[model samples]
Target chain A: MPGRGLNLTDLSYFPGCSLESSARESNISMMEAAEILGLNLIELEDWNCCGSSSANILDKEIAFSLAVRNLSLAPPDRPLMAMCPRCLYHLREAHQRLKEEPETLRAQERRWGRPISLGLSIIHFLEVLVRLGPARLQQGLVRNLNGLKFVPYYGCTLFRPPSLRQGSYYQGEMGNVLTMLGGVPLDKALTQRCCGSFLSAARADVVTPLVNEILASAVAAGAECLVTSCAMCQLNLEIRCTWEPRLPIFHFSEILALALGAQDYEGWFTRHLVDPRPLLQARELIP
Target chain B: MNPPAPALNLRGAASPIVLAEQDRYLARDIERLSRANLSRCFHCRSCGNGCPFIRGMDYPPNGIIRLVQYGLRRQALESHTIWICVGCHTCSVQCPMGIDIAAIMATLRRLALAEGAMIAETNILDFHREVLQSIKQYGRAHKLGIMLRYKARVRQWFADLDVGLRMLAKRKMDLKASRVKAIGEITRLFIPHWKR
Candidate 1:
């Protein structure tokens, strides 16, 4: 609400693979939130996988090419908005690399069968929310989550390597969003910790400890729930950790949707491994 | 009674510090391939300390950089560190030298696959392959297909059976692969580029 009249009319959305599958709740909540904000989310047509954590590790060219394919599909005028941090990072990195190396871009253009343009900006949903301002968000809140102490978890992808970070390194935008929703945002040290990412698929043993440490730190900070932007982070954090008295992990969009008076938000909770409804009911946010 | 082993000669001999010519070439090759200035690393353990997966790695981040500097390509490529990186970019951000350690790790992984270097963690490699194969078939990742292929390849179908079942019950698993209309375009991108 920093800017009283500022409004985002429409944005090109890129819901990565996880959003279409495992993180369907995130997609639902994001669409619902967009509706409340009077924002039109225009999903990029024929957008393929960004070739995130896996593609770059296997082959750099494939990663770049895969992301370029998606980039080529975005509308030339509007900036592309992504929900998943990994996809956002890959798209941004690919854009940067394409700008740096025109030859690579030309090669990809030939493969993609189109003239590639690097002018289209790639923005994360978190950044969009921050730019929308907490004041604006507060104006639209139907329910006040005053007592809910939430920790904003910004797993690795959002702010790293210094180049890809949009705003502050820590997810201050998430905190602003929580604050706007009348939720207490807890300041925790491990907010930017790694959730072991794709390691969960190959070596859950290595991921378990990292996930435990993140959860323990959040609980120690007296958080009622954890909010994050990354779908993979949510999946790894929720599925990998099985401690007694588990903290419910909710995507930032889900909370925003709930605050914006989305009735069917409860349906999304059923997919969670750690049930978050109990926590919501305890806060009297849900009846 | 065990026989005593002979003592090694303590006399002056050629030191084992001789650098192989191939090692130097390998070091230069890694530098060119990763586009990271190997000389920039001052042996700072920042990358190693910041890496969450370092404990499970045969060679830590700094150790890998050192190996690259020393032109020990085989040791560096074969280290489980490259495969276990998880691509979190923690080390890359933490490095004081501003070197993208994660990018270097990616380069090493690609080199490992292409050069037929020994892979310490076959499961990680298999997982990547399965994911890429899924992407190649469909425009996007087909979760069920990828998981099934991965399980078949690794022969660990029951590794996370309960989790798989739970996901299925929650309707998180997609039964079919999604294909983009321009599937032929994606295929063209892969066929020529990756086939090398």
Candidate 2:
């Protein structure tokens, strides 16, 4: 609840790998949204990758060491905010594990050449915004997305494995954000389904059907666009969606940025595989 | 014309079922490594039922757990299930016993790689290796470099080429690699863990 009291102005932000590369739109929009809401995001200096999904599967020790390195680098005074769900999950899980097993932390510290401690609370950006509450979000809203029907896709990492389950796992905060912005929030079952994740890179055949199911469900629910917080989910859904009547995938921050009257919204949409401008313009949510 | 009836065989072919002691050791090792408590699974099949990639798996999540319980190490480790698991954590979330089945899958993958077991899905493992190599080279992921290296290693140069082009056109893919300022520290962290 860092953003709840309005006293939380500055945050230590971990942009992770995807935010710097494929998910640049998410990074841009998130910064724009935060600026409008008067929140300061300080990027962690000399930070490395968070190990993501591949590192854990390949070697747990490496994953732990990597996350511990990142954790050690983060500023301890402010709460650490991770934009990517995978990074947040890995960092939080590693923090918990390292705290529980001091011996492991000691070993990692020996390897990393730095002392580590779980001083800062690692949180997702969505959680920070949610804790800020809808009323605070409403204060900056210039254009209400009245007719835009958005399906809030939580993906898997943000809300799974019991440790990371944020209350209901349906990403109600996304719904709350959309609702506060005067948009229709479709909190359907498919919104929380896995997007086949990294498998999209190796096995698209397996992922295509799953992605199709998610898209089909959103379309079936009469959704105009699919809003997700995860970068991998956005990539998989947009790239694998080859079927007819494709739905534009929007990072939740993009919508939030638009609602806050960001003028260069078209720049963000240009990077998306499926352009969302048509839907937004049709509803006059964007010019 | 009617098809001729097949003749019945007089004797059935028999195969030996040997329970190796090594299987028990392997099961114990997996249990120790994952800390998943294989005995806690009661064939509920909740993990299998909830698994999104069950259809692609040679053995379902419950079946893999059952294999672990019975100490069928060869069968469990060689299964396509471990390779196919995307680590979505659905099985772990839905497990009534609160077992982190995905963690077990990760252990199985490591064991499989260590034992040089025949991987049913080679591309997935290859992709993982390429991604790790990219992380090792650059502190952050370079999308273009990763994809190019992965394609070259997997020898599927043409695969997803169209999507790659589209991403490039859309400015979604970064051509240049970005390295963290403290890459030496990152390399130091990986060297010891990877050496083992």
Task: Name the candidate that leads on lDDT.
Answer: 2
Q: Please give, for residues B1-196, the per-residue lDDT of candidate 1 as tens digits.
A: 7654322121221123334533777768877887888789997789888888876787778778877776767777888888988767888888889888887887888889898999989998888888888888787888888888888999988898888888888877889776777788777767764574
Which parts of model 2 are misplaced by more than 4 Å?
A1-7, A107-115, A165-170, B1-17, B20-22, B193-196
| Candidate 2: residue pairs that collide | none
Clashes of 1: 3
Q: lDDT scores for all predictions?
A: 0.81, 0.82
lDDT of 2 by residue, A7-57 (tens): 457888999999998999899999999999989999988788898778777
Could you list the iRMS of every candidate? 1.4, 1.3
> Candidate 1: where is the Cα deviation over 4 Å?
A1-7, A166-170, B1-22, B193-196
Q: What is the Å distance of residue A212 in model 1 from its true position?
A: 0.8
Looking at candidate 1 chain B, the ten consecutive residues that score lowest on lDDT are B6-15
Ten residues in a row with the worst lDDT in model 1 chain A? A1-10
Fraction of native A-B contacts kept, per candidate: 0.74, 0.78
lDDT of 2 by residue, B1-196 (tens): 7654321111121212245533667667878988878778887889988888876777788877766776777777878889999888899989999889998998988988888888878888888887787778887778788888889888998989899999999988888887887777766656664574
